[model samples]
Target: MTTAVAATATAARQGPRPRGLIWTVLRVHRPALLVWCAYVLLMVGWMLWVQHVSGARIRAELDACRRRPEGACIDVMTFSHSMNEGWIGTFIAYSSYGIAAWAGAALVGRELERGTAQLAWTQSVTPTRWLTVKLAVPAVALTAGTTVLVLVYRWFWSADEVLRGDEWYYTDPFLNRGPAILAYALCALAVGALAGLALRRSLPALAVAFGFVLWFHLYLDDHWSELWPMRTITGTVSGHDLDALPASHFWPLHLMTTGVVLTVAVAATGAAYWLLRRRTR
Candidate 1:
């Protein structure tokens, strides 16, 4: 009877408790996440270089404006719209894509593909706790990354008169807000979770995640006329053609994405829990 009790206790301790699950998830995921960090760092580095080039052009524009009298160089007023015309714009746009999609796809989507959910289930932890930890890790990382992105964007966007001339141009929708990027990334993560849980194939999961990210950008672009409410804040510069939309518009997208991400992640986790527990018992 004592041996039987000891065996049961050992089995119970070995099951998927919160602490064990967190540790297991972390152990399996941390190295991959570190590589993700390196990718983000490289992305930032590339952006810095792009900004440097844009800064030079803005300086040149300002210099030209300064060379003439206010009335003669009045075209300089359009500097706001033109600042994003060249290399920096390309870099920023691409960086935004990378941050918004690829960053989280690898972590969230891959887990589902590899059948790691079953491993977690056999342990004592609940599905809700499992999903929470998975979501938390990326969300925390994105928050920190976004804080830095915002600070850098603000500093660079404000540095030159020409750069600041067009609020919307230098504002670079792709580069302006960290929260927006996070929202987008979370959406992609959720898509990945769905793919992971449903398809159970890594390549397909990643493809779906990538497709969703692409669709999101497309939706924002094609539907901007009707959907401008959730993307930007409104402001008008004295001489620019572009209108600064309100950031309030983007809040809904943020909220919607959050809901979708949670739903997919949770549902998949729950399904995993049900499937695993049913199988094991």
Candidate 2:
């Protein structure tokens, strides 16, 4: 009897198994977690390899060309530029679009379509908490992953100007050079969650979310320069003469756009919550 009483006391102190909603969300979406990790690592590793390996090769060829004044150095430089600006840029753009689709279909819509979200709600978790966990986990993960990629990209972008000679106004360089990428990732997540909640169907939500993100990206690409007024330099500049902002003005424009995108994300998240609450009521 004394042993039984002691066991009961211990059980009371230990409490029930700690199966948190956040943990449940994570457990359910572990495959996506792996994918996100792989993508971040791949991009970071590629940039590092380019910066230390391919970039070094290009530099060596340039030095050799300077000494000899003849060789395939121009070809080397051209290849390096294409790899850096063309391939990497395209990968980043597609990855951003993929995030929106994944969030809409795999993260939220599938669960709702399968009635798993309803099952979760019936079990002691509130609808608000359910949706919160859904949004919060992906938001945190996306932000961290995108921020790491941005930092690595920036390092490679500025490391060797001769090898990866990409202009600031280029689509890839412009987007990956600052915190704007993270903002876009978060916006995509929010937009995906909203679409999934509204549609409650995986395929439709995926299509709509991707389309919205694509449109937003295209809009920004066309009008990003107009976000901040360009400063004209009348004097002779070393590069081509064009009406554009100075290099120093890049971050200001990016930050302003980031702010706008993040605001839209917040609004989308708020709307999702309101709609969920109303549906549950």
Candidate 3:
């Protein structure tokens, strides 16, 4: 018998077996998976293109002006900084908002609203397993994609010190520079699940999830500087330098905030599980 015929015959003889809960969740959310893949591909591709083109521009400008750019070289350098660091960093920082919205509206809320989740529960899949898969699959996808972007951003950022607009201390760049962004994203997912389970409707869940995250991020932004003890310069430093945070504190501040965010993520996830169990019980 041919290989194809043998396989078909084997399958027919074995009969159909039940698909795993994870596989079922993935199949149901295939569109979302595709969208995430596209988003990561497009974002990574764009950042690479920007790095290449901007590297060329910076080199050209450096050569033309002998490294001390006087006129047009400054503009090119500035624009390159905006593209390479400003735009890319901003996207990396704020992309969690989109994740939050989609998690609430598409992943959980709509499934519940349309009785899709309920239908799944009848198929020997416990509600707990269903909810666990729903959160786990997206969390893994988000972490993987976000890790790629963070690595590329760091690679691109290292080559981009000369073109200066965004700095490591800036909110958007700072978040992109560390695990804080990833923590924020996971927290967003958890919060979104909680919102969906609470509202049981797509649009309202989407709005509440997005708004809560927006406020949460803004709060972090305003308070992140206080997460760690700031060192003061007793020496004679001029104007803005007086208020400027010591560069050495970058890691301390970053890690402290990352811990805070991750703590919140864990708490939110706990809340989600608690809520799911309560309602289903």
TM per candidate comes to: 0.59, 0.88, 0.88
Report the alpha-carbon TM-score of model 3 versus the true structure: 0.88
lDDT of 2 by residue, 65-175 (tens): 887755534575648565675687668755768888998998889999999999988999999999988888888888888888888888878777766667887878888
lDDT of 3 at 220: 93
Instruction: List runs of model 3 lying over 4 Å from the truth.
Output: 1-5, 8-18, 67-74, 235-243
Cα RMSD of all models vs. native, in order, equals: 9.0, 3.9, 3.6
* lDDT at residue 19 of model 3 (Cα atoms): 68
Output the TM-score of candidate 2.
Answer: 0.88
lDDT of 2: 0.83
Model 2, position 241: C-alpha lDDT score? 61
Model 3: which ten-residue window has the lowest total lDDT?
234-243
